[model samples]
Target: MAPEMISIHGGVFRMGSDRFYPEEGPVHEVAVEPFELDATPVTVAQFAAFVDATGYVTTAERP
Candidate 1:
């Protein structure tokens, strides 16, 4: 199926995991420019297609 284009407005957000990780701390706010995020997690079919197209091996395949 052909992909559809979507428009989204930009906004500021506090991004972090709320963990001891120093980078994640401070809970600082950020102004993120408009961009597209995947609407959902990758499906099995999508993963298969990626592996097939690139013959891309994942770390799991390594001992």
Candidate 2:
């Protein structure tokens, strides 16, 4: 069975921080597009099954 998913609405929101590291400074507004997210994190066994069935290759498996 496929995993459950959550639909997110698109919107603008504040991102980052100005009080922390220099790179994290300059808080600004960010626009987000609608997207779907898995309801829960995938388990190792589930991921392994998916890879076996689809022959999916993870980045870590590549040099």
Candidate 3:
């Protein structure tokens, strides 16, 4: 079975931080559109199963 996804309503909000990193600063206003997101986070075992089925190799696996 596939995982469920939830719809997120879009809105305007202040983004970024001005105190932490110099590149992240200047908190600016941004608008976002509705989007769908996974209802739950992926589990390590699920990822392992995907890798096994697809023979996928992560960057960490490479030298």
Candidate 4:
């Protein structure tokens, strides 16, 4: 099955929480350009299948 995908429009959105962990503190607005993302998490098996079928190498695998 194909993975579901979503399109994100360019905009600024508040991220992180000031009341949470220290690392997550200082809540701020982040600007992002348009992008695409998978609507749901991809499984390892599914990822492997796609890579194998496409003979694709991930950036991490590069020497």
Best by lDDT: 3
Total colliding residue pairs, candidate 2: 0
Pick by lDDT: 3 or 4, better one: 3
Candidate 2 on 1-63: residue-level lDDT in tens? 777999999999999898878898689999999999999998899889889999999899888
TM-score of each: 0.44, 0.66, 0.58, 0.54
CA lDDT of each candidate?
0.79, 0.92, 0.95, 0.90
Q: Native-vs-model 2 lDDT?
A: 0.92
Stretches > 4 Å off in candidate 2: 45-63
Question: Which RMSD values do the candidates have, in order?
Answer: 4.9, 2.9, 4.1, 3.9
* Tens digit of per-residue lDDT, candidate 4, span 1-63: 666789989999999997869999688999999999999988899899889899999999899
TM-score of structure candidate 3: 0.58
Error in Å for residue 59 of model 1? 12
Q: Residues 1-63, candidate 1, lDDT per residue (tens digit)?
A: 634545677999997766778777778789978976555576899889989999998998977
Ranking by TM-score: 2, 3, 4, 1
Model 4 steric clash total = 0
Of 2 and 4, the candidate ranking higher by TM-score:
2
Which prediction has the highest TM-score against the true structure?
Answer: 2
lDDT accuracy of residue 16 in candidate 2 = 88
Q: Which candidate model has the greater lDDT, 1 or 2?
A: 2
